[model samples]
Target: MPLRLVKRLARDWFLLGMLCAVVLAVLFPEFGASGGPMHADVVADVGIFAVFLLHGLGLPAAQLRAGVVTWRVHVVVQTFTFVVFPLLWWLGDAAVGRWLPSDVSLGLLYLCAVPSTISSSVAMTGAARGNVPAAIFNASLSSLLGIVLTPLIIGLFASATGQSLSMGEAVLKLATLLLLPLALGQLLRPLVGAWFARYRPYTNAFDRAMILLLVYASFCDSIASGAFSKYGAQVLGLAFLGAVLLLAIVLALTTRVARGLGFSKEDEIAVVFCGSKKTLASGVPMARLLFGANPALGLIVLPLMFYHQAQLLVCSLLAERYARRPAPPPGA
Candidate 1:
């Protein structure tokens, strides 16, 4: 590859790390599998707690408050994320679910029901010189809503499929694993917020590291349980294609809808970026909590992993293109 290509690829360190994690899981499943020497389950649980705590601690409350007045942008982004995306997956599943393993189909549905990403959505909106405050507000709100909405959405899917999911139990676990820690972090943020801000880079590193660890552990459990062996490469290939197509559809739809609503150029950029993306940070841990040690956990997260990387590559390019546009005339 050219040096420029190499540099670009290197910038996607999380993507590279994820691939390495899968490779490691495939080669030595025992090391990271649930009861393996690493005690991955305990580690993952603890890490999940810390992850949410840090999120609460770092949440920009003032910015979110500032952005709240832009209810129009929030509604559009949230609708695309929680409504249109899930409806697309449901229709897609109805058309093609028979060809895919049930787990993969469910994974795609889960992907749609999750929230818009936080850091990337804001970063991309800013890179594109869009409405950054609105992006931050909408993205953060999506994640918060996802805490209640994701499981409920999954429960609805479960009902449609005749699978039993205990909503009460799921809610309790979510509170303990996700909600409580987040609240506690927010409560404690006044004391530690400055500390966390000063060490923002380290906190971000921990966040990435936890995600990779969860990926490795989830794949290890799946491999050890013979999940991949049950489904051939063709299933995975189709799922990858589905992820790409889904992203494309959402991107086009969000852009069209933004324009149709007569949003300004900057608002349009925010809508497209914030509305089209999903968060792996929230998805992986949520999957683990939802699915537990089920053998199919790995397959269930496959679509999300694929979608995460796809959004990153596609949005990065799109953001750059938007950034290159000529500045609007003053007081247009």
Candidate 2:
């Protein structure tokens, strides 16, 4: 490869690194699996807490309040997050649940149930010159809502699919791993929120690091337990395709809905970005708490990892296209 080409490809170094990390974990399960001298499971727990703490501290109380004031846009965005996305996944479950292990379909549904992303969705909205306030509100609210809604949605799916889980235990784990630290961050936000804001770039990187670690841990455990063998390339490949289809269907639907609702161009951009994407940062940790013990956890999350990458590429291009268009003639 040409030197410039190599560097250009490396522009998305983090995504490439994430793919390589999963591959290495799949091949060397022992390094990531629990019950080792390094105690990966313990480290993962601490990392999860830190990730959400940053979430709480970094969120802006002013933006959140402003978001609530514009409840009209949020109603559509939140509806897509909690309702439209899950309904599509539920349809997928009905259509293909019997074909794969319950874990595979359940994970897809779990990803759907998780909230819209806080960072990328908001940033992309800002890039497209959309409603930044609405983006921030919907994404932040979705994360908080997912703390409870995700587990409940999973519990409902488990009941339907004959998958057994101790809901009480799962909810408790979420409260601890996901919610408590978030609450602490919010509480302490008043004390040191400015400091957290100053270190935004580092804190964002820290969030990604924690997610990568959690993903690595899941794949390690899954591979260590022979989970990949159960899900051959044929099945995993199909899941990736399904994730693409899922995003396409969502994009198409959100665009049509946004237009039909007669939303302004900016509001449509916010709706499309905030409504269509899922939060890997939230999904990965939730997967750890909800499906950590399941051997097929790795396979379950495989679709989500692919879906996350796919959305980022598609949305970036779409946002840029929107940005390039001429602005409305100063409100006509």
Candidate 3:
């Protein structure tokens, strides 16, 4: 393509980083696989904990203290995040399971069960001149809710499929690897929150680095275990298409619902971004804990890997479009 277009595409740095990570994983899986020299899982767990700790530190205390009293907005965003998306995916699985590999289907279902993203949702909301505070609140709330909810949703899914779930184990993993660190960070926020918030850009970059490490390590383990061997080019393409279709459906639904509910333009933007995005940062760790060396993990996370990149590109374009809109007449 043209130079400018390449640069534009490259602006989604994390997306590009993820692509590079995949290649490295495929070629040199030993470093990140189980019992590898690097102790990848332990490192990833620490990174996740630290990233969320910074998230807790950097969060705007006043906004969170005010809380999500906008029950209408919170209800809609959380419902779509935790309920509508998963329900649709479950129904889709029933209707389309015959067409998809069982592993891919389960992965898609798991993708549906995760939380809304954190930084990107808020960042995109700000770029689009949306209600940034509301986006932050909703996205953070969704992450916290996901700690409790993703496991439950997946447990129900496993139960319905007559699959076993180690719920206690999953819960413990989440608490240690995700929640406790965040709680500790929040507790210490009084002491360091200001500094973290002042250097927010740097902290956010660190968070992205941790995410890249986690994604790379997980894919490395899967590749090492031959988890990707069953997926041919055709299967990979199908997973990509499935993820795109799901993202489109959620985007369209959120847009229509926000408009129909008579939300202001700003709130609509928050709804569109927060309600439609999913967190790769949270999903990878949760999958590791849930699946625990299941060889199908590479396939299970395939849809999410595709969907995460797709959402970044799609939302960036939408944010640009929103930025270009004429401003409303001041004070009407």
Better TM-score candidate (2, 3): 2
User: Measured by TM-score, how close is model 2 to the native structure?
Assistant: 0.93
> Candidate 2, residue 37: CA error in Å?
2.6
Considering lDDT, which of the candidate structures 1 and 3 is the better prediction for this target? 1
CA lDDT of each candidate?
0.89, 0.83, 0.83
Clashing pairs in 3: none
User: What ranges in model 2 sit over 4 Å off?
Assistant: 1-9, 330-332
Clashes of each: 0, 0, 0
Q: Model 1: how far is 146 from its true place, Å?
A: 0.5
Per-candidate TM-scores read 0.96, 0.93, 0.93
After aligning candidate 2 to the native by TM-score, how far in Å is the CA of 279 from where it should be?
Answer: 0.5
Could you give me the TM-score of model 1 versus the true structure? 0.96
Instruction: Encode model 1's per-residue lDDT on 91-193: one tens digit a residue.
Output: 8888987777777787888888888899999999999999999999999999889988999888887554435567898788788999998899889988989
Candidate 1 runs further than 4 Å off: 1-7, 159-163
Mind giving the per-residue lDDT tens digits that candidate 2 earns over 158-260? 7656676778998899899888998999899999988888888888888888888888888888888887776667767766887899999999988899999
| Candidate 3 RMSD computed on C-alpha atoms after optimal superposition onto the true structure | 2.1
lDDT: worst 10-residue window of model 3: 1-10
